[model samples]
Target: MATNDNVYRLQGLSCMNCAAKFEKNIRAISTVEDAQVNFGALKLTVKGDATIAQLEKAGAFDGIKVLSENEPPPENTTPFWRKRESITTIISLFFIIAGYVLYFQLEPKSPFTIGTFALAIIIGGYDLFKVGLKNLVKLDFDMKTLMTIAIIGAAIIGEWGEGAIVVFLFALSEALESFSINKARKSIRTLINIAPRKAMIKRGNSVEELNVEDIRINDIMILKPGEKAAMDGEIIKGESSLNQATITGESIPVHKTFGDEVFAGTINQEGYLEVRVTKRVEDTTLSKIIHLVEEAQAERAPSQQFVDKFAKYYTPAIMAIALLVAILPPIVVGASWTEWIYLGLAVLVVGCPCALVISTPVAIVTAIGNAARNGILIKGGIHLEETGRLNAIAFDKTGTLTEGTPEVTDIVPTEPYSEADILSLAHAIEAYSQHPLASAIIKKAKLVEGKKVNAENFQSITGKGAKAVINGKEVYIGNSVLFEEIGSLPRESKQRISSLQAEGKTVMILGTSNEVYGIIAVADQIRKSSFSIIDQLFKLGIQKTIMLTGDNKTTAVAIGNQLGLSETRADLLPEDKLTTIKSLQQKYGKVAMVGDGVNDAPALASANVGIAMGGAGTDTALETANIALMADDLEKLPYTISLSRKALHVIKQNIAFSLGLKIIALLLVIPGWLTLWLAIIADVGATLLVVLNSMRLMRAGERSSIENNV
Candidate 1:
């Protein structure tokens, strides 16, 4: 993240084991101090100085090509059948079929028949043997090393036809593994291609098409109906409905007008608009989402780390078992040496670590990519896994559960002062304040004509209210606590404040040091979607839905009852919210805290998972929270939890299925029933099934309406 100079992207990096070995080779270079390969992301980060040629040479065994992070990935224009891997497999298959015909038609020991089988083996296993033999010499025990030993040992035993067929099967399996990885990476590729490469910039008089990279901040972009935005900006003129499904996962077309922020890759519908660019192409929301998703892929899940550690020991143990199978049967039991050795070779083929090594990463990658496409940014696999197990969730009341836009609902005045007098005096003190309650009083004051009075020496009271000097008198505007401190409240005033507070409205007292002037009430409306979201959380097995707020207990309880919350903690400071999160974790196994990302920083950080709302175009929201919902609405909360649970389930299933199949195939060695091709088939079948299972995550969420229309 510091700079792109040392980070590079990789092509043809499909095997996790090969990636690990390649990283070590790069670090061995004298100029390189450290190297790490993120197999899930197919990226490499090298510390110290290293040339591209040097990095490429390190990965040459796997045919990996290194490209600068900024470079665009090359398009695959060649037909699949014409690609190098496919062509090699096809030619090898033809030779194997011809060899089979010659073995039956001519003598089994004929020179031509054996030559054809040897040609098949050489052609199909060139890359495999190249990497496998090098690993063999180093005393490494990867799948390739096991595979190389199996095929060569079979050839030395004079099983020419079996060796050639096994070679073709292994090559075909490798091709399928590559294809499946690419398929899982398609979501990331779609995100990269969402924004247009060119934009129409309004330069002085005439509009001209220009590349997005050439456009700068403050440039005016001309957008017409049915056009996608090329950069992030605010609309300066015109209005339209824009489909932002690709960015926020909201399928509906949201209406956008002057001053509304628009992100790149969103389609503008039914209006011509001019936008003032706010951010460069790389700084857009879509670009950040893409980068975060890639980084999430690189962060290994607990299951992935476990599998990687397990395979380190699992691979070497398989070799030991194979060696024992070959020696003990021939020496201890007096079985035929040729037949028992062949069985040992089959055991090596069955024990290839491909399926187990690939099982968890494929699932993690697919789930993270899918979550990004749905407008939910899951920061890493650890958070994704934690979300699935959350039993309790804490919510911040003001901006998260409520609309956050407070309005002036009621104003009461003493007998000496009129409504106009109260509005004017309160607006004078609150006008300079930036709080949401201040905005509401200011808005209501504008609608009613009030006395033109200005307050001097204004000061804001933290956690209480604001005060200023009006007509040489010290006036105060805050809650009952400030008023009670200055002067005793009359019984009527107390009753009136209590009534308003019970109605879920925030009551602010307006008075001077000696006598009370009146009471002003402001209320923030709850979001319409809040009730259903709470219900959905309950149905999803969330045990406790607690609300944390700084409001009075009366108001907090009033709002909590309406939303059916299980608990409410009112009059809480930022630190109190954090303590509550820790308490919830103690009571429940895991807890999630949802807030506006900035205000609830302490609580969000303390909770097991922090969810931020309205992440689109907001950099702080993206950076601060563990999970960010792009849209301002809470409709996606249930969907995110559902997807995470499904991902966890699939990851477990893939791991169990991969290891289970290998164990069953290893059992076949007891009866001497496993053949070279059959062992290869079992490994290939398990790998293919695991990949397909992980890909189910791509279709887990509902299809966006824009996709439906397309």
Candidate 2:
């Protein structure tokens, strides 16, 4: 907020419209250059120099409160019974119960009986009237203001029972609304509390337990078997498998050892670990995820924006129509004033836009929060909605659809040599270089530490291969292109190279300046889930599943055939991968690009939705992609798609249910069949129903990808 200064938690804000109202008012402050209210997450951020005092005062005007980071949450200070809305609702219930006893079990219309009903109205109506009267005085009408007028008008016409019912039902719905929403919000709190507050740090010859906030960068954290990693750090000592479900959403434990990275909340399943902290407590990936997720929940979807726009004009139009229904009938048609006026009040009560206004935000918030818990990050409401509409998704071949690690499958010599001879020389050259296939050749030859051939003049050819001087021989260990540079790739080897490529093996030429010595082939296996995931995408309505890779066409086609991909583009540079994404976009209205989020960053950026793999790049997944499937599991892609489509359907159901129910309730009024109690029931009932319908998303996404065995 203000480039970096202001972030506040909003308390007592359950209505999206009220949050918008407070936001507009805060931005109007001269000192507040910008302001945003995240209704779903209940946060307010401000720019410029607006102090906490200024924001709190402004928010208090609408019964909303702003608590800065340093301030204690309102829940800690205020008891449930002492809260204004809670206290008023409790008091209103008392009077309504007494009024019901007097009317149904005894006599009606006595002064004492009517006085009891009047007490219900006055007690229940106070909170609404406080906010509603202010709005009425300013001509800023909303649901509260509408209810306030309807209740007063009902009591004036001697319908004491209906008036009490309006207050009691309205207050009941408000309580339920708060309860249901807080239930949805508990997911974020649960995630925030995952990491232990204190951690065991390794000091000189001893270990000391300290609060996470007290831990500093470069601190050595000691994690024993079965202990969670204390902070985001590099593993300086020990080896273990880590269950990173909290960050990566993968249930399988990832092996971690010397020089490997570990996150603050991941579990060390075995062995001992000494980690050197790389990030401060607040800057850990988990903390950043929590903050960005909260912010993402605040963004509005297209349907949400549409509802807000519709509510702006719909409320005033309803009021005008209700006025004409009351006064115009008596003036023009000579209809009974009493009956028409009652009908007008019924229209006002039913016409409150509470249900319609809340339809989308609640569902979107619930769905997004649930997705986060399950290892998929739906960044914003817009992305959540867009993901629902994706018809095609392009996958990066290496890390996305296949195991990125390639292994030596074959070693062949050209002339007067055995496989071992070719491997010995190839491993000699590969040992001195860092290439994707270097370890494959070295491991095939069983060349261990202190047993490798010494070499010098090492140079790596990016994307093609590498070269080195091995045992006084200039050996080229790379693809055919490296041999072509030497003015010769023997014609006899072309057939063998073609055969290897056709089998999806990356063929590397082993030769010198004089003649070709040997050839080595490496192949990375396809992931076990790739075939089923591709099939599932089609089952989930994906029109096309394509692969983009820099591998040669023969190898790409070979892998593509095994996986049954709809299409494949091979032998392409990074730029070529990006252009193919554009072509897919032109072919499909909306397509998703899935990659590792590093090398594929350009194509991932260009697609309609970008999904990254692994637990790496938490911030990139946040800032770069619309969605992220943790652990790089292609199975999560279908689950992500299913969740998005489910959320979309739920949102549409809510909007239609809210508006359709209201229209039917209003139509009953034309026949003079709608009563004050019935009108309020329809209005408040829809609000609670809308809220409950949205809350279903909270648990609907609870299915674990691990338990599902995907």
Candidate 3:
């Protein structure tokens, strides 16, 4: 079952139903083990060894062309009027008008009139009839098969003008659908075009331009002002302000210096720089975003699943109903054969199901493409739908809502020792520890000029604190529990520690074996966008926003209150956070968890929707969460939720209008009022309206001023 697969690009693959049939045809080939087609991406992947000739033969019915993955897609430079389909449509329209003129001026069945109508049908329906006739032999009842049968029936009933008109209108309808879908697809194509194809590489003294794929890791790439980066790498040489709008959607340019990572598609505004390439071209951030988005577009949501299932039986059922209308009326009701047969043909035209079939996919493709352009990567249609339905959201406290870096805020020393003495001693012991709080202490100590004294016999206690010998005295550093075991703490010191904890500051104690030195308070700064994002979510109908953390209950509750969160769960380990998420799910039907993707993987997997922040910087975040916000800030979260809800609404509207139009047209059969003109117009009009309705999602990516301010 495991084998190397070859992916190929496809041309002229526009219909979802035809794409399915083409995939099946490829699988039937003896040389191919399996094959799949991504209708949204217009790509075909085949397993086993199948020649290009074999694949092309399988797709011949729909006139599809297969190209190697390495081959460049042909540029679409031809004007719309010069296209093959357009030329044929124009000629068919001219012939239909000529035929109608002859019908009113001369005899209705005159040889000239019938000959003109025949030309129109042949010109307009040639491609449709070819594919439809082939599918008909295989008993495939798709939209084309229904239209083909209706056109032929109209011709047999001496309605050449109606048949010719039906052919013209259906051709125009498909053209409109193709145009709208391609407009949606252009959003993704724009992303793929953001990165440059070539880079300037320096080897020893000389620099040469090479393809990005040819550049190896650790190779130095030289970038000049106004140049776009060709690969993902770290800067080793200069500083510049780079516009990272392609990767993070930040309108403002970011300043980058030595050791800063730059993405493949960002633009360098000024200054010269040399970067060390870190990833291959295929593994770059832009490449992964494109791959994920294409896969997301292929994934079906709950509504799409329902529509696909409904269409499977709906098409066959329509055929049976058309058959009964043609036969039963002539027999049981004693109706005229010609009139009822004409009515049956009209019913077939209205029942093509093209509008209903395309309703969900068009909206899904547009919304996902829009999200990607705005630096939000939704992994699947299912997740996009679930995000819109989320009533509750849980947040991880440390890195998600606040800046992860902790800084020392206050220092309290006893009467015998000044603040400087406490900091100097604490810094000596903390120099050997790698804890975050220790870093904060060291940073503060470096700000003042003090003698550096090395601590001897440094030992890190597992859950308590560290102890070491400084100036021939054993000093202890940790929480109150560590010093409590050594000696009793004064009542005033306990009250001071409580005050710092109540302000959401982490308190670190420093002392000797028998006496307390002082306490240092450190806290993480809250992000400026946190309050506004939470408030916006509430206005959008989110009922609850909770924070989960491993910090003390007092600290967690203090921070939660400042952000106006509905609840706070503290002192929770990684697994305990997972349990809390499960509990939230039972209380609220649908819940979402937001976190720094690596540590919160368990809780993220348990929630209905897992959103990861700063995905542009970490590969784990991109792969772990259901939705990845590329920017480091949470400015995009509210916008992502808003877009998903709008997509859901548009899909519902499309489905309702598609079905409503068909029902109205079908009702005309009771009084024999339905004609080929009205039936084809109704069907074509419905399909056009559904496609246009889905296109509205393209404008949803424009960020609000409030979001941009952050």
Candidate 4:
């Protein structure tokens, strides 16, 4: 039994409705003393002796699921009808059909028509009456109150059919809204389920399977040829090609060898390896990604905040309007009471709020789905909307635009030795060292199949260089700083090193027996897609592209020029990059920062939209950024921006079309030109039209010919 303060993360939440249902259902369990769900946070907090497993079973309700029990419940509450939405929908439809049949097929004023009207009232209007009465006591005039008043006023004036239609259409629209929200939240649930439940651990040349939580750091884990690594670790032996699509969204497999890092939840495609766990279950990359995603979902965007504020006032104000329509129109025009009451009912049906409530969510869901299909995962609707409006983009140079790994591209020798000879001797000394630049030289030398010359009395100097006896001769492999400490640099070698440095290459000098032999220049390669992505951004209406990098100015400018960027800042640490992003935002109004490494976390969080490159397995990037690009391919950036813009455009069209139609209908209602059937058609027809329009976002790839263009 855990203490009263214990908290657990709950998974399998499909929507706010599911969260609410789980919370309500869990309260019925005896050991569950109390449970509160923070739907906004996607967590459930429980204070009781109930174990996680017990709480999970107890919290399961119809259409509701409980995930891990270690965290508090989410804050979002369930909708009223989710538990029995299907039943309510069926009942509402039946009443609508019966009412229409009885009114049209039977004689006017028939007993069947009256009975049908009564059934409609009970089926559709009962919930509205109960909600209105409850809210009326709290002085909270909700949408239900507006609806109840309109229906009752119609019944009072002998317009029972009109009242029935209003409630029926409203009920149907609410059900649809609930369903759409559930669909929007399904992606999060799917992502949470990807974490592995168990791990294969190697113990004393034997293997045993255990729960993921029971595995510890530094444990030797054996990953078979086709198994997913269950935790983050380094390959201690063997080699494999891993399909990292689950993490990076890249369809291609990445080759991994000794000393390379492997993440849990990524499938190993070929070969087998023994890995030394570098991270525990809780700290694994997959866990961090899950944790970060949950947090990002809870964060409200500025536009969503506006919607929340509008909902608070919009419901009450509409109720007052319905009352005015019901009472004042009859008094002003000397119209029959029933006619004015029917006009009030029209207003209630028009103000169902289906359009307003779903406007943002529909666009959000469509945008997220579209983005995901194109290898980008936008954490929330807010990010999609905000990113679409960005005026400028800031990028981290290394890893984002250029491959971070340095490679030896050019080697120049002085008087006594050729390039191959210099490389061979240098590789002999560097093979014993683990420095990045040293590794690059050694890798290149190995490509040439150079002889491995053993060194005697090898000594490494921290941050300076290395000295060793190679072939009974003293060999020094390091920078000019190390040589300056011993003797003056040779004229030819000094000139070559200076030239390479000016060309933005890191120069490493190799010397033998007090004479400088040769120089190797290493540089990071530009990603093949970077230039094209920058060009695509221009076509997408982005006004500026800026590069922020820790690399030196020469290298940064070379890459920036290749991409035709307008601004470039080099030699920036992580904090400096963040400052640069802030300054750009202050100048340009809105800026998006994109990077692919853990160091980019702060800047990614601070930007108007933080976009992570190759984010599939990088948890910090995925969680911190508003959007994550799963593939290393940068071409998707423009596609994502286009999708978001199109989604927002669709939302605007729906809102305008729905509102315009409603206003025109209200005007006609007062003049007696619009009847009960017309009001119902207008309400349902407009809702369906908006829904179809929102669905256009799903087909944006086809509509815009994005695939063909790409």
Candidate 5:
């Protein structure tokens, strides 16, 4: 279903030059106020009151037609025989065969030959003639006008056979271009169809089927084995191994428990499950991925802009040169009129600029679509291009390089108090704070389940830590700095803290004004895949991987060394992280900052490309990152960079191959080696090659074979 609105989704737009032409013409129509055509996105947005019939003429050359966003598709009304392009192709082919048969097999100079040839010219090239005549009368010279003039010149010179063949081949090329674009559009259509149309939801106690949109947030949905999850939710009952490749691009089936998260479009493999929907249908991660991918195609890259602007004048310049070729040699060196005219017509045929204009948009669109199919979502062409050039990457330790959940690893208490006694006191004071360390101490309290310490006068010391009075005694619980301020921290406690920090643990001091109680150690384990991912990045030609953290130098260095990081800047506040990101950008050409917390937002904004992990579950993931890896797996980072660089390489290759052929064709004009048919073939061949080269990016997911080197 589609809707008729200002934003019109389009299909069957194969030619970038023709799309540009449609944009220009549609804007000029009196019923239109504004028109914009995104060639890569294959969409046309217009503010107008024009009917479908009038708009169709604007897109007639490119075979583009608008589709509504929320209306059911109309049934086919035209018979297959009456389809305009097919009818013209069929009728033109009949006249072409008839003309050749009458001339060679029957009568050499028969009137039947001329009649059939004229019919072929009129039938196959009628649209070209009409557009060209309109443009000529309007004093506008474009590709259609260029070809029509060449066709008339050939006929006037009595080269009817070449002219007739030229019309037939050009029509066939247009049809082929249309078909190629439709083939590419099918990929996006498949993505749209991945989610199931209907979902089963429980209303009160009854399970009923409903449209996906009608299933609201917090609804209970039952997922049968081998069925796709209808919405993003948390499993409330049962267990299953779900294949989540559609959302995260992970090949393995992930096991889900009572509270584990699941996304729409992922299949439940083993057990039936009840899920509490966490997000509405439109707010699901799958929908956002599709929207971002479409928007990315609309954002033209710098190279694409340059090519499009160059094409605006490239054709007219060629027409001027062809005029000179037609008249100059005949006047200066007594060359034959028909011979020079023939060479000029060949030049005109080669100067359409279809291949040159398509060079960037097709590659950009194909690459964006390919990346979306995988887990890595590149937000736009600019970010995609920047990511491929990144030389260094900075990672925030918590929730990124390390598992974010911290645990109390060790507890050291002085002679007077037992381990349980110290933990109860620490938990009572830590419960007043909301920091990650506080959470770890509270969790330890629950595990050891002892008498609660009733503390009075709770006060937070900002970065130092919190303090509270326990059991009518002036008590303090914090780091060494907070305890040292009251002259209560024991000198021997420094040795114990240093030893624990060196083991990559955060040490917290629990003490009071008169005596020290103990030191509690907490540590967040580094991700098992972090070292391998860092190694892969280096193999992919990344020059540096750095860690920036607010943790002690001993702990930061411990983690950095294990991961083979180039540098570790420890004990950094949020502002320090921002400075490190800016400094990295200075030393390296481009730096990508990876982080998931609010503290990392500044650094992420300052970096060349901001990469967020576990975008599927975060509110800031989409807004704060240039690229979002839906799953938290660090391995996807290397794959993302490799895919971006591959796209860049293909884009460069397509542009080079297209322009190089045009240069060689233009050079052939000097020796008059270019013929009309050869020139047309070269243009069509170049276009097809550019399209085929861009399509190579469709295998981005399978390109993980390069991960060994990376």
Candidate 6:
């Protein structure tokens, strides 16, 4: 059975009482199956099969804000004034029309003249005045403040109609700009709203409906058909198909059975499953995603920080310039006060920092959204900016460039044994051993249905191999060192081992008491996409691509050459890998490191930007990576790098465009050629244009498609 649900990442939320109050209103929705709130992470996880439209309608409840809805914003944030921007535009236009009508019809000496001007000021300047007063107290000297100053200044000089028209147009443009920026940030908020709130807990034979936060570890929860799983857990019983699109951005539903891991917020489809909770509600994958997203949003990119710091001084300096333009010109040239003040008002309007303040954030937000849609989660805008500047890329070879799983490829036997017999005997002797190489041999043996032998005395040698008395004969399965210790070694077997090792294969010696039985060659396979990724990186002007692995020199060189890597280092321990990365960083200035799992976590974290291959369920890789690929597809790395570069390019373009327009507008304002309305147009219009341009990153899929054709 399913229940009502409501979910949100509530900031600074504390106590179960707050959770209860939040749940009380959410549960009122008839379709809500369950509601849960985690005070620790300050997130509310809710689940129900209700459509997004239903949840949006339910979100209208008091004190409850749905950060996202089925439909996109202005419906999402749904501010009071935005729903009426068109109406406000019409009303402002009415005042403009009225002022023009009075200017043409009324005589200058008429008593109704004052009323007309007063009506113009009241109609056009009310909202501007309100905003100006609020900002004035906060000392936020923005374009709105400048517009307010210019409008009142115009009124003081008896240009009432000009003042009204200027404030009205400026307010309208500001509203539009605000609306567009909010729309640009819509994707980030949508990503944050993915986690569900309620879970179905199986309490004994009966199922009890509970909030996700109340879910304890090991509690068996039933994920109903078509609903999202509300917590991170293992499926202990039953079967189901799940759509993990929200979490991984994948479109297909993955089939799940007993002992399979299921993530929170993944859609359950086609069947029901009893999932035992493996993680606390606060520690679920969805919570981690939400936490990362929030951190990304709160963190500013380097370019953004630069712009912000620049504006802190830039705005006040512009104000000071406006002051000098007002007094210095009139004093030096003996110009009339009206003429210089008009120049000053123009300066103030032109000095507004709207474009400068908005340039970088818009690009950063767009890039982040673009990355997320492609199954790459960039932790913050800073990481995106840094990634775009990567001069070198270091790769962890084991799981990054090669499939870490090594398999037995070729087997050569000596003297009496055939290849099949050698493999069977080696598998038999090593069956009692638990080493990884031993398991690989055993698995290969099982593939051909090799007979299992009941060995008499099994002796395992530390750091070497295993020996056993099989069918009244002694057998040894180990490396060359073990065979040497036992006694005789054949020249042909040694030659075969050398040839295989030269070809980048691990040669394990299989022997009996005093004779060499065979040589089994095991090798790690290169990832199909690694070669293409290297070429793409080189094409993108990346200086070098290097491989670091714990494998021996032969294996590393072979894999590196096959993948076209510029350099390769082998026989490196974990600390050695760190030293190598640090040395490369010192030479290259900035580097990116990619790896598949946790063993490379330190190197991934130490690099300029850490990219982790996440599809393989490497928790450490996912947790430590600055950029995480949700799919095993390594081709996405090139796309991610391209996207970051494009985003950085767009940010530069925006910053240039904004600053260039501001300079030109400021120069024009000093000469009285630019008016308050024109300044507002330049300020808000440039901001809107840049914001729209930045949002083009969201269409990266289209770009990728075109690139694929090329």
Instruction: Write model 1 residue lDDT over 1-710, tens digit each, in one string.
Output: 34333889888775877788899899899988888887766778888789999998998888889998867567465766687988999999999999999999998779999899999999999888987898889987788888899999988998889999888988887887777677667778888889999999997898899999899999999999999999999999999999999989988999999999999999999999999999998899999998888888889889988998898788779888988888898899899999988989998998898988889888888888878888999999999999988899899998889988998889999989988999999999988899889899989999999888899999999988989999998889998888887775888999999999899998998888878888899998899999999997787778899999998788889999999999999999999999989999999979999998888989988899999999998787899889999998788887877777778888898988888888888888888888888888888878888888887777856644212311
Segments of candidate 4 deviating more than 4 angstroms:
1-105, 120-140, 196-241, 255-264, 268-283, 365-381, 414-416, 429-434, 450-503, 508-519, 573-575, 596-602, 612-658, 669-710
In terms of lDDT, the poorest run of 10 residues in model 6 is 11-20
**TM-score for each candidate, following the candidate numbering:** 0.86, 0.89, 0.92, 0.78, 0.83, 0.84
On TM-score, the candidate that comes out on top is 3
Question: Over all chains combined, what TM-score does candidate 2 have?
Answer: 0.89
What tens-digit string does per-residue lDDT give for candidate 2 at 135-170?
889988888888888888887777888889898888
Can you tell me which runs of candidate 5 are displaced by over 4 Å? Answer: 1-5, 29-31, 48-54, 60-63, 71-140, 160-176, 217-219, 233-241, 255-262, 270-280, 408-435, 438-478, 482-493, 509-520, 571-576, 705-710
Q: List model 3 lDDT by residue over 61-93, tens digit each.
A: 777899986553564667767878878988999
Please write out the lDDT profile of model 6 over residues 453-526, one tens digit for every residue: 67768899898878898788888877778887877667777788888888788888877767887889888878
TM-score of 5: 0.83
Higher TM-score: candidate 3 or 5?
3
lDDT agreement with native, every candidate: 0.87, 0.81, 0.89, 0.72, 0.81, 0.73
Model 5 local distance difference test score: 0.81
Candidate 2, after superposition: displacement of residue 241 in Å? Answer: 3.6
Pairing residues by index, what is the TM-score of model 6?
0.84
Clashing pairs in 5: 2-68, 2-69, 2-70, 2-71, 3-68, 3-69, 3-70
Q: List the residue pairs that clash in candidate 1.
A: none
